[model samples]
Target chain A: MSDVTGGGSGADDAADSDDAAGADFDGAQRTGDVPTLSATDVEAGYDQHQVLHGITFESRDGVTCIFGPNGSGKSTFLKTMNGIVPVWDGTITYGDVDLTDEKPEDIVTHGIATLPQGGGIFASLSVEENLNVGAFTVDDADAIAERKAEVLEVFPALEDKLDQKARELSGGQQMMVSLGRAMMTGADTFLLDEPSAGLAPRLVDDAFGLIERLVDRGAQVILIEQNVRAALRLADYVYILAEGEVQFHGPPEDLSEEDELMELYLGL
Target chain B: MVDIGLFTQIVINGLLLGGIYVTIGVGFSLAFGVLEVVDFAVGEYVMVGAFMGAVLAPLFGAEGVFVIPIVLVVFFAVGALIQPLIHHVTTGDRPHPLLMGLVFTFGLATFLRGSVLTIFGPNSQDVPSSLLTGGIEVPGLGTFPVVRTVTAVFGVTGLAVFMYYLYRTRGGMAIRAIAEDRTNARLMGININRYQSIAYGAYAALTGSAGVFIGMTFNASPGMGLQYTAFAFFMVVLAGMGYLPGVIVAGIVLGLTQSFTAVYISGNAVLLVLFAIIYVVLLVSPAGILGKGEWAT
Candidate 1:
């Protein structure tokens, strides 16, 4: 498992380390200021229908996997954090900044990157252009190149296929592009919703492997997934949501022990 | 006996006529491609631009060419201003966002046409450019009318510039990303509204400038916009919806068909012939003439 470096600068000095392929992620590793996101009693929905009702949440040490059934409001909760969906009531704070009213573009600057279901790569864009888009907030050309270089090291297969349109890539390769695009932002925390949703059975493990790599690097991740056991393997904390509310929140071991909750919500 | 010179001239006219369509198609395609708005006001934009050329040409010593720059700026600003309105009606959990956009732009088109007709009446107004009058005579090819040649040049040049901007720049990447998935684009820290505005503004600026050149080529009149509007639609459909490179080919096909049909068939049958081709293309390859465009939704 490689430690994927996260945060601080668009151009993290991954080049400074001798083994950039495994260890160095753009920014210099730090002791603190990891910027844990805390959401309190968050309520949101589309139009008049309410999906989430006062669900308070926080990131765990490494990966916090949110497991839910379809229409469970897990995806909507992720969107609220990313600002794709607005929070009707309740406060979301990233370290000290209030993210409740912040726009999606603004949320990215705060170093929280969300990858919507199916990796969210712009299908028509070339792999290279999709990577370039990751650093959309960065102005300096050198930073973009450096961040891309760092991402390429992680998903080295993408280097050869940079010029090809993203849709042309295989399932696993598209996930790499999607992950690689997100990495371009220097995000300290990743909000991924259903990263494995559309992937083939053979590629499902590979999708979780990619997420594991983000966690191995020290980035805080809040993942929403339907794959119960696959997500549990990577989860430091587990959240089970049923009908837009948290049915359970604790260690993954505890989640398994709650036979009734697991059987009812996760269909375990 | 068939006059070879006349035939050659018709061929040249058709190709040049295609160039004019290229200008309108590129902008219309961009608006549809980037913003997903089937802007009904595209033709009115051209009409207004020609009227601007007509009204402003005299102040610039009746050189219609001088108004291109000013029209580009005015139209760009107007377009930028209008883009938010389009974005407003088309975004969020709205039912039939595409239809909403079409209807809004349709109303806008009607308003613009009515205003121009009321102000200018039904009279055809000349946008005189002494510099563009006369013909450049080639020894054997044909006499290329200077105005048509320049108009063609303007159209092709605008297409090239748009091509370069869309494919080679960061701003281009932003808009393309927005076109692909608006929510994800916002996640990438791309301000969706700003890029949409820029895309629409550039489209308006180019389309409006084409009007000035068109007015110089023919006479600008209140009733002239509908024909060009139909031609613009034909270009996009034939070019492949949202496919940029396909525009030139679509334009040439439409132009040559119009020129040849008007001469060999009937001046009245030109519209009928173009419609027939469009119908066939739609039935066969809804993706576009080259079968490379996004399937028209």
Candidate 2:
């Protein structure tokens, strides 16, 4: 379990970071340059039913994993940050700007991108088209082409499948497309919802590998995950939510010691 | 009945008419593909376009050709306004969005038809277009009416443009993303309402413009809409609902069948034969004639 997250590769991962993720996502540049995402007493929910009950948290520089059982408002909170679910009562701020009233489309322009579960893809669209859609915020064709080239370098397998429809790709490849597509936005921050939801068991590690690569590149990632073991391995900071409230939030090693709550919610 | 000249002429007529069907089907398929709405108002839009030509042509020196640009803008605006209403009724805890959209558009169709009948007084009106008159007589291939040939060109050209927009343009990709899943589209930072309106507006605009050409081909009558509505349905069903490429194939099938049945069998039996063909298609390939669309539920 210790091999999965922080303290394992702080020294060696940086060596591979530059070659693997690229200079645009240079880890050194992101360590302090990116703005902190702070959620203060955020409240939101679907129609007539409240889901998030004044949850407060902040995203760390690396991976911030939100772990919970079913119906724990993990996904809802993530939506609130990305501006998908409107903040019913409280405010969510990225760095200094209050994103409470912003729409998801507006939020991405501020350098925040989101990936829904099942690698939410345009099934009928080709891989190239999917990536192009991600660059909706960016108008410069040269910049788009450069980012596309960078994305292909990260996931070389998708190079040949640029013209192939997304639905035709395997589950693992679709996940790559989702991640690669998000990269096209040139966003500094990411909100990923259940990235490993529908993957085959062997492919789960590969999905986590992609996330680790994102972290290595220095993009701040806020992930909602059910795969506790894999997520904890990548998490620099962890939060456990039972209902809508944050039960515990601290370092990964600290949460592992709370046996009772771990068993009740995470089955860890 | 089997004279070579007559057969070739019928074939030419069928192909040309099929081109017009393609124009209507392209828009109808786009509506279904992007909005997930099986709009019943499709034919009414065409009828209204034809009527616009009828009403506005004389003002512009009686050329329906000049009415195209005006109809495009008007229908696009109307479609954009109506799309949000469709979105409102169909989304958020509304079960059976497909049904809701169908019913809404059906009501819209009725409203459009009734309004035209009321305003025009149930009479056939000519959309005079001197620019698209007569035929190009070929020594061996027979005469091809400039009007039908031009309409076919418009249909095919419209389909080509739509294909380019859908397959190559970034805006087209955004609409496709929304069609796949709205929630995901939002997560990708796509403005769902904006793109949907663009898609519906384009559909309405193209469909309406096709009406002007159709008006030039046939007189603009209040009841002419129902025939188009039926043909549009046949077009989508045969095109495999929402499948753009299949629209051309479906149009050909419809055009040839209508021409042959009207000429060889009985002019009256065309409707009956069309219905029978549709019934068989539904039974055998509910997905579509090309086996590549959402299955009829």
Candidate 3:
């Protein structure tokens, strides 16, 4: 290990491809090297039936990738991160803050932006409009313009499609816009659910490249993806989930290679 | 098969009547568009505005023309408040908001109507008008009611302003975008609840204006809501809920059809014949003549 789980100065860390875990928090207050995200015995469900039964997990820093089959409560877990789903028996805390009870809108203001699975762009709105709308927390007009320009720089494909309706774009382009929309908020943590879903093989590669760029830019990425091999290669740490429980959590190298982990969960 | 002047009168009246229909239809459509539920009590809300105008016109010495803004402001608040309450009561994991909204608003409507009956009495109250009394004389055509002409102008102007706000203003764009796709809009940080309130407010303004016109043209009574409710509902679904321009046309066509039917057929048979024509039209164009299918999607 390259100490990918640490936090540091964030300047040089952002410049370098290394984890630079301590560098992300080197400024004034020494609030520990790794950021804390905890779900303490959470039981979430619909009206009557509980889908998530007392689930608990903790992530220090860097990308914490969650892998599971379709019905293993993966989407529900992601929704709970931003308070989309109510916690039945557990609490989610970021540092000292109790985020388990906050509203979804309030969660976004706290630097946690959720890029929901599928193309979450406003289908009828233009690409520029969609991106601008995403900057809902940014109040100052000048700041909004600056962020819009900056995001466009990061994703050049969105630049030319500014005036085009989001629904008119291809699935991959829509995903790019979705990322651009989320990037507008300057979120420190990303709760991405299956960014590669429904994307063609070529677009998936491009989208993965974009994700790498995001991780390189000093944002902590939490990806919940089905593509086990790709996720293992990209993620510093991995958590394997089955039947609404965490069966394994550690460095990707610790897992018995890609095929072994697949056979354990997929029964292939 | 009738006098040319009478035919012309029917046509003009139909057009003017259509303007009022457009105003009411727009309110109904906007409420449904934003909230995914029809304010079934909207008919009563219109009645409330009409009664408000009826009561205030006598006190302020203001006619129908001036009472619009006051009625609009009052009803806008009413719309905003009522929408959230409906959302609170019936919004949690309900499959059919339309059905729940209808049931809830219908109860509200009944309560409002009973309140009006108890306070204002069953007898109809008159709303005096001065601004739209005289007719505008054209060269060949006979004089048209000044009120009817102005209402038509209000109809077109209201739609123009509404459409502009929906496309041009930041707030308006947010509303339409949210209406089209709520989850995506939420991801963009558009406050769903706030924009929904604004949409309800706009609905109130439209229906409030219709109420004012109703008061100016006819007497206000507890039963007035029922009279307009059926027609307003027909126009909304007939024009297709999402088609703004189509709603306007549908309103006008509905008015004209009613007027012509009343002229050629028996007064008692007018509604029956008009509804028949509407059913035929709906059958021919399931999405309403100019309406699109994407609105439902």
The CAPRI quality class of candidate 1 comes to high
* DockQ values per model: 0.86, 0.60, 0.43
Cα lDDT of model 1 by residue, A1-268, tens digit: 0123332343454554454444466533432446778899999999999999888899876898888889999989998999989999999998887999999998898888888888889999999999989988876676677778888888999989999999899989999999988888878889998888889999999888888888777678898888888888888998888788988899988877789998888888
Candidate 3's C-alpha runs over 4 A off are A1-36, A59-62, A257-261, B1-9, B266-270, B295-297
Residue B182 Cα positional deviation in candidate 1, in Å, after optimal superposition: 1.3
Ordered from best to worst DockQ, the candidate numbers read: 1, 2, 3
Candidate 2 Cα errors over 4 Å, as ranges: A1-28
Q: Per-residue lDDT for A32 in model 2?
A: 52
Give me the candidate number with maximum TM-score.
Answer: 1
How does residue B66 of candidate 3 score in lDDT? 78
User: Sorted on lDDT, highest at the top, how do the candidates line up?
Assistant: 1, 2, 3
Clashing pairs in 1: A4-A217, A12-A26, A12-A27, A13-A26
- Residue B190 miss distance in model 2 (angstroms): 2.5
Candidate 1 local lDDT, B1-297, one digit each (tens): 999999999999999988988878888888997788998899888899999999898876759988899999999999999999999999888999999999999999989889999987889899978888799999899989999999999888888888788889999999889888888899999998999999999999998999999899887887777888888898898888888889879888988998999999998898789989999999998988788898755
Point out where model 1 deviates above 4 Å: A1-23, A27-32
Candidate 1 C-alpha error for residue B251, in Å: 1.5
Candidate 3 TM-score, C-alpha based: 0.87
